[model samples]
Target: MSLKVAVIGCGSIATHRHLPEYAANENVEITAVCDIVGERAEEAAAKYQAKAYTDYKTLLKEESIDAVSVCLPNYLHAPVSIDALNTGAHVLCEKPMATSIEEADKMIEAAERNGKKLMIGHNQRFVASHQKAKELIESGAIGKVYSFRTAFGHGGPEGWSADGKESWFFKKDEAFIGAMGDLGVHKADLARYLLQDEFVEVGAFVETSAKENTDVDDNATLILKSAKGTIGTLAASWAYTAKEDNSTIIYGEKATLRLEDDPTYSLVAQYANGETVKYELGAIQSNDEGGQTTTHVINHFIEAIQNNTVPLIDGIEGKKSLAIILGALESVKTKRIYSLEK
Candidate 1:
């Protein structure tokens, strides 16, 4: 039985990730696509052979969807996801799940009460390098992980806009926040997956340096303490000029593992026993970052729905990662460290 999907945002993520990946899978069918902009929805629907709608509520009401992917901006995440969950559709929502912990909690509550699977689009977990890192760490090559660091940076998505003009990426009203919400959550979620622990405390410094008109931080760095006592650093930016960078390094008592940097592979693991291992994780997608994230998350959600299993990045995991990022922002505003414990 093929699972029918309805997509609520027809932006870059929907085009690059959910639509294409779902179209490729015989078990999944994208039955409806929605966007506030009718043209955007039309383009996506034409490409994916889905029904286009300007209103997502109508799409949900008419589509008979087995699942939904909410790729809307931050402020809309909770409402859209809760609505979908209430409709009895499993949902995979794009990250920075909500602008605040309160909203994320509501989304989680909706999922639980509705008895539906709710996954977060923390695509970095599905990336080849990160996935391989998990495999290596689980193999016991790196024993008793201690500390870690990760970063995700790139020049602004200015060049990727639909009209080569400013869009919601720079609008605070639409985006809710900037680089931290845009990119930091990727590393936050990735770190959680690699460490297998939820972060409990965060101290951060954030600034808006690149885009003068934007009201949110464009560069931010976070220091985090996990529930298990592991310390980590997460940095995110939209101002890097050279190229994209996403990397993580983990140090364990037995060996060290590096992902996405110092090598194209997942790591350079040097054990205390004078042995070394290199694991290469090939390209996880066809050169589309958001697309890769969307695809991987979707597949996991679909499988979870089918098998009645928990997704790798469930709503609780999403809430935890979002709490870290939100705490970082809160720390910056209050000029003190914020509790992930909240």
Candidate 2:
């Protein structure tokens, strides 16, 4: 029997990533869709032939869902995920897992107690170029990565969010964070995945200079130190008016690897001896490019549920990535380097 699934939020992330991907996956059926805006929920439900719900609580109580994609706002991630897990459904929550680490821990605990899988939708780890970069790094192509810089920037969420400029992404209470949570968390997760290391400390300059009427930050730059003493910068910005910049550069002892830094190649490696190689792996998904047809996140979540296995980006991994952003926010508030060592 096909696993019955539901999408908790009918927002951009759900429309672009979860809904379409789930519809295409033959192993699952879209059972319901929920959104506060009745029209949005109705539209998505009609398109997918699923039930519509304005309240997630009602849907969870009624639907016999086997899995759910919690694509709600940052603040709702933890609670909705916990609720879904308790309802005997595996959950695939969007990025910036929770507004706070304490909330994230509770979500993880709920999943464990319910014996259900909880995965974070950090699609960067599944990108072809990023996966190839990890392979190269693991194969000793880039010897002893010393320093790196990764960035994720765009024109802003107004163009991407389903609600436009009035979106919850600009609200401090609803979103809890701005670019750092939206874009920066992805890079933080990517950096850890690529290096296979954990960040020990973080220092950040998170600000809201670009957008008006928003209590949250519009741009942020974080300096991070890994457990292995590797240092690097991770930048997230909504002020890049020209074009999106999702790129990473890893400086190593023998070579420097660049991922999504060039237009022609998805990944490039330059050796110290003047040899350079470029890989034309597919382009990284971008809002400008109409987003990706499949991010591989939904599929992976389904696979994990079907196989009764833990997802690669499980709740624990999600919490670790969230800690980086939370640490950066604390660093900004306290004007001191935030330590993740504890």
Candidate 3:
């Protein structure tokens, strides 16, 4: 039987990643598409031959959905996902799992109580270059990892959002965060995945300098200390006017590994012995160009449900990543190193 899937948002992420990927999967059926904007919902539903709903609560109550992708604004992630889970449907929630840890915990608890799979849409972890980098790092390609720096930046979300400049991406109440939640959370999660460690301490200087007509941050720089004593810098911004910079460089005792840093190579390694190796794995998906490719998030979520296994980026993993961004926000307010242990 095909998995009856429903997408609760008709925004950029839903249109680009979830809907297309699910539609392409033979084992999946797009049963419904919902959006507050009736036209957007109708358009997506018409394209996928699914029912259109202006309200997600109505969709949940009416449709016999086996799985759901909660792609709403940051504030709605937890409530929508918890509702879907309570309705006995697995949920694939977008990144920045929730506005708060309490909400994240509720989403996780709902999934567990209902025996459903809850996955976060952190696509960076599933990138080809990232996967290969993880394998190489585990194989001692760079020896003992010491420190690193990672960044994810673009012009802004104005062009990408369905609502353009008036989108919820810039609203403090709706997004609860700006660059950090939009881009920083991904790097935080990626760093954890790559290093196989947890961040214990975070300090940051977050600001809303670039964009006008918004109170949320458009730039942020974070310093992180991992549980294993590894330290690194993470930069997330909407102020990169030239080009997107989704890259990470890890320094180790024997060598350095760079992912998505070079224009030509996806992964590059420079050894202390003056040896250089470049792996043309694949291009990292960017907001401006070459992002049409499948993110592998929806397919992986489906497989996890079908196989009765945990998703690679499960609820707990999502919360861990969210905690980092939350910690960074707290650091900004307190002007002190935010400890994740607390």
Q: List all candidate RMSDs to the true structure.
A: 2.1, 0.8, 0.8
| Pairs in clash, predicted candidate 2 | none
How does candidate 2 score on lDDT?
A: 0.94
lDDT of 1 by residue, 37-113 (tens): 99999999898888999999998888799999998878899999999999999999998898888899899999999
Against the reference, the lDDT scores of all candidates come to 0.83, 0.94, 0.94
User: What is residue 14's positional error in candidate 3, in angstroms?
Assistant: 0.8
Q: What's the alpha carbon RMSD for model 2?
A: 0.8
Q: Model 1, residue 239: what's the lDDT?
A: 86
TM-score against truth, every candidate? 0.93, 0.99, 0.99
lDDT of 3 by residue, 262-335 (tens): 99999998999999999998777777763577789989999999999999999999999999999998998999
Local accuracy of candidate 2 as per-residue lDDT tens digits, 1-342: 799999999999999889999999999999999999999999999999999999999999999999999998888999999999999999999998999989999999999999999999999999898999899999998899999999999999999999899999999889999999999999999999999999999999988999999999999999999999999999999999999999999999989999999998999999999999999988788889787546888888999998999898998999999999999988998999999999
lDDT of 3: 0.94
Off by over 4 Å in 2: none
